[model samples]
Target: MDGKRALYYAAIGIAVLIGVSIVVSVVSALLSLAWAIVSGIVSLAVLAGVVYVLYKTGAWLLGGDDADYSASDSVGGSRSASASTDAAAESRQDRLRRQYVEGQISEAEFERRIASELETEEPDDVDRKVADIEQELERER
Candidate 1:
């Protein structure tokens, strides 16, 4: 009986030691991961700053396209770019609406995603595109 009791206490102590080691290992790993993520972000930010500075310097040296960069003023070029971009965005929204209607996505998620998509573009253009989609939906119904 005395030997059995000693063995049981030893087993419990071993288990406690193992548990503490595991916990310590997990904490260290998490800290390392966090440090790595922060370091990576700082590095990327510094690289981006360097690239931007170099681009600005090069642009200045080349007499920056302020004079002949009027490509956006072209009749078809800018209009086509705008129209295609709007169409792609409208299609994405339409797919999201369909997913919501089909119960594949929650209304809240749909609203959040759509709002994020619209936020990237001009408010008036987004509004007009949304109105056009609404009209098309009404016609379908």
Candidate 2:
């Protein structure tokens, strides 16, 4: 009778030990999964922040107002012909200035282009030449 009682107690102890081990394993797995989810979210948030910063920096560096003006100007075509011509000339000058500032063209080349742009008396000729120059620049790019 004594031996049987001892065996019963040993069996119960083994069962309890197995139960505790299983509980610990399950809790550890859950914690690991939670950590992985948190890490993923943090990584995504960091990536989004970097992209936002880059976008804002680019807009600031490239002149946000210029982009806005071009968009609005293209959408609204109600300006007078003379005003449009003057705007076109100003746009061309701005482009040339940007190119020069960026070192895409030498000072002499920039000056020559500006002079050629200014020498055109007729609006039609100016438009045609400007189109040609734009095409050439695009090809170079």
Candidate 3:
């Protein structure tokens, strides 16, 4: 087995051994009870320390919670996926057209904005045009 799986098994074995030792002391003999309790406590403490050290040192690893794993896994391909982006652009254009048709924005203003967006004649003016578009969208709302 891998080191990680071995560590997990070792941890469980330590826990079970501690429990069995305690039980044997209580039932089989009272003279060993004190020793058993002390040994059990010490064993468990050492097991915990070993587990923690293995975890921190990258020797042992466990999977995260299912919900978190599922969430992040679902989003794993999102950065490279363009499925929703085209729909968003179409929706934005539709909203702009609707606003113009509803008399919220003038035809001349809409044409001017479209020209400014599509022509790309001035790289320096892109930011200003984007700001203007945002202001117009805000006003439409």
Candidate 4:
């Protein structure tokens, strides 16, 4: 009878130990998951901070005006404001040519408009235009 009682206690002890081990494993897993979540959030916060700092620094270095720089200017060198004006003039000329070719304007009207366009050019641009005309004439010859 005493031996049976000892066996019963031993079985209970083993069961208790197994239960404790399972509980410990579950708790450890939960803690690990919590730690991973916290770590991920912290990492994202740090990344965002880094990006913001970089953005502020870049803005400061670029005179704090975002509009002053363009993506094309970054890829190539910076262009003067006059260069944009010249581009606008070129676009206008292209539109005029298209209009003339499409019969929206007569030949005499086209010539008059083109002469007016050339007359409105900046003084500095005139030399360039003359050079371009000379080059075209040479190419024709």
- Lowest summed lDDT across 10 adjacent residues in model 4 is found at 67-76
Task: Rank candidates, TM-score, best first.
Answer: 4, 2, 1, 3
lDDT for model 2, on a 0 to 1 scale?
0.69
Can you give the lDDT of residue 16 in candidate 3? 100
The prediction achieving the highest TM-score against the true structure is: 4
Q: Estimate each model's TM-score.
A: 0.43, 0.44, 0.23, 0.45
Distance (Å) between predicted and true CA of 115, model 3? Answer: 2.4
Runs in model 1 lying further than 4 Å from the true structure: 66-141
lDDT of 2 by residue, 1-141 (tens): 999999999999999999999999999999999999999999999999999888877775565534534322322323344545577675877688678768899867986987787686477656655564555455545
lDDT score, residue 81, model 3?
A: 29
Candidate 2 residue-wise lDDT at 14: 99
Ranking by lDDT: 2, 1, 4, 3
Question: Which of the numbered candidates is closest to the native, going by highest lDDT?
Answer: 2
Model 3 clash count equals 0
What lDDT tens digits, residue by residue, belong to model 3 across residues 1-141? 699999999999999999999998777787577779999999999999999776755522232222212112121222212323344343444456567868888877876766654463345444444555556556656
Q: In angstroms, what RMSD does candidate 1 have relative to the true structure? A: 19.2
lDDT of each: 0.68, 0.69, 0.57, 0.66
Clashing pairs in 2: none
| Clash count, candidate 4 | 0
TM-score of 3: 0.23
